[model samples]
Target: MSRPPRHDEATLLDAAVRLAAAGGPAAVTMSAVARESGAPNGSVYHRFPQRSALLAELWLRTLGEFHDACLPVFAEHAEPHLAAGAAARQVVAWSRAHRERAVVLLHGVEAFGRAEWPAAQLRRERQAARRVRQAVTGLAERLGAETPLDLDRVSLAVVGLPLAVVRRHLHAGTPLPGHAEELAERGAIDLLRGGGS
Candidate 1:
């Protein structure tokens, strides 16, 4: 059998994550990933083929991982408000658990060259977005949302509010505070209950 390659796709991707986390999407070139992973330049090219491909894979993987962590929390609670709070708190908790990936996500898909992504990558991005929209819509409906504004409130409570908390700390390169989960949970519940008057 032929000898196994020294560097794998996952290894290269992890290095890309580090580079993106440290210096944003502009840092994650194929050459940079190779250098960061100690892999041959050809190895990265072997997996990614182009800089846009590498960026797309890195962004999709990070986004998929985040959705995996937060979406399940929505299904775990029977009560809509409880589910919303849990989902919000999960956003902060996942960020705390995966700091580098969190930072990568904070850079957003546009920063990852989404406009240049291959069709397959773009489809995957849409699928992930659909999943989030479905979950948020379901929760909002369960919470008696009747108007577009009501849906917006639920979206803010479960997604926007928690992300704001994460963004504040991560953008500053500061660790999330110890009470982040509680703060996220409480803020989400308050938003859901307060309503727009």
Candidate 2:
């Protein structure tokens, strides 16, 4: 008998993401992932012991990827406002390039039952949270207290505004407008320049 090709964890996770994107979290069963990926049910189960594990892994992995993409932008721009603009641009650019993953992120962890995730996965979530907090704190420190910027306002300009811009398209299942990145960049910069008023 011929053996089935082994599908790696990424392939399986990719399938899961597609399923979630297409039909929401309810559609992401192991069998559905196996069917979507053209892998056997056993293969899906082999990588993810249960649905919760799969969901947790997918959510965490997606967040990790987004955070990873943005981390370098801070270092790339020494100025806090420039860095904020970079972050806003990154949010739009990343979402445009990876709409499916972006949808999952917009839906957030609660959709994937994050509260019930296993202990280890919860730890992973906490670590990701720390990285995000650290990035924000570092940026705030660089901006300095004398500056008009504060963590709350900077966050709104860099993260909140960009997310709001993308969330509309993702929720509607529409392609982001061609001007999305430019608009996001301008909005972030203008907000910061205006002292976030």
Candidate 3:
């Protein structure tokens, strides 16, 4: 049998994540991934035929991982309000636990050259987006979100508010505060409860 390859796709993608986290999406070129991962340039090319492919894979993987972490939080809780709170808290918790990936996520798919992604990547991206939309809709329905504004509020509670907390701390290059999870959880519940107005 031929010798096993040294650097795998995951290793190269991880290197891309680090590069993107440190210098943004523009930093994650093929050669840069090779250098960061200590893999041969050929290995990087073998795994990702082009820079756009690498970027797409990196973005998709990060998004999938994030969903994996947060979706279960929504599913596990019996009460919609409690589920919303836990989901919000889980966002902060996931970000803190996966700072580098979170940084990559903050930049988003467009920054990762989504326009240039191959058809397969685009399909995968759409599937992930649909999954999130479905989850959000289910949660909103369970929360008795009746109007457009009510659905918007649920979206804010579960996604926007927690992301705001993560974005603020990440952009500032500061550690997420000790109260980050609590703040996210409380902010979500408050929004869901009509902001206590």
Candidate 4:
């Protein structure tokens, strides 16, 4: 007799990410994920009754990984401005390295709606956004500018700068331009210190 199958939440989530990244969110289904994971469909439903729950868990895991990826920037630089620039460049580098996953995350549609899952996903997303924004705003504040800069605008610039650059490159099916990292770093710096330049 075959040994009892062993599958865990992590395995399901990994399969989900792979499926979604390869074929977009619409391709991720209970049977498809189970087949990819070598588990039964009931296992998928057991862990995540709806696809949205699976998507939410997958996205949360992605954010955790992204945050860990950026953590090194802060470790290397204690200064807020330098750290912020390093963080932006690092994120861009990660996107280049993980193009499929990055693209899936950057532009994919959310197949699952708020009504489909626990409210915790929404709360976690908002908290994560706030933390990232706070990091950017703190960097801007440390620029020693004569006048106080607009925190919200600078925060949006800081967050959007890397994404915009990566989005264009991925959409074009091209590698990041030679100056992409440099531009991302400089853009972050300018947004933080250059008075909205």
User: Which candidate achieves the best lDDT against the true structure?
Assistant: 1
lDDT of 2 by residue, 43-161 (tens): 88888998899999999998999988876787678777788788899989999999999988888789999888999999999999898878877777776634544678777877899
**Which parts of model 3 are misplaced by more than 4 Å?**
1-4, 195-197
lDDT of each: 0.93, 0.86, 0.92, 0.72
Per-residue CA lDDT of model 3 for 158-183, tens digit only, reads 99999999997897789999999999
Worst 10 residues of 1 by lDDT: 188-197
**Residue 150 lDDT (model 4):** 63
* Per-model TM against the reference: 0.96, 0.92, 0.96, 0.79
> How many pairs of residues collide in each model?
0, 0, 0, 0
Q: After superposition, how far is residue 183 of candidate 3 from its true place, in Å?
A: 0.3
Cand. 1 Cα-lDDT: 0.93
List model 4 lDDT by residue over 39-124, tens digit each: 99899999988878887887777777777677457447767666667877887888887776676677533553545557888888
Tens digits of per-residue lDDT, candidate 1, 1-197, equal 99876798889999999999999999999889999999999999999989999999999999999999899899899998889999999999999999999999988899999999999999999999999999999998889999999999999999999999989899899989999999999999989888941
Clashing pairs in 4: none
Model 2 ranges off by over 4 Å: 1-5, 145-149
Per-residue lDDT value at 17 in model 3:
91
Q: Which of the two, 2 or 4, has more lDDT? A: 2
Indicate the TM-score of model 4: 0.79
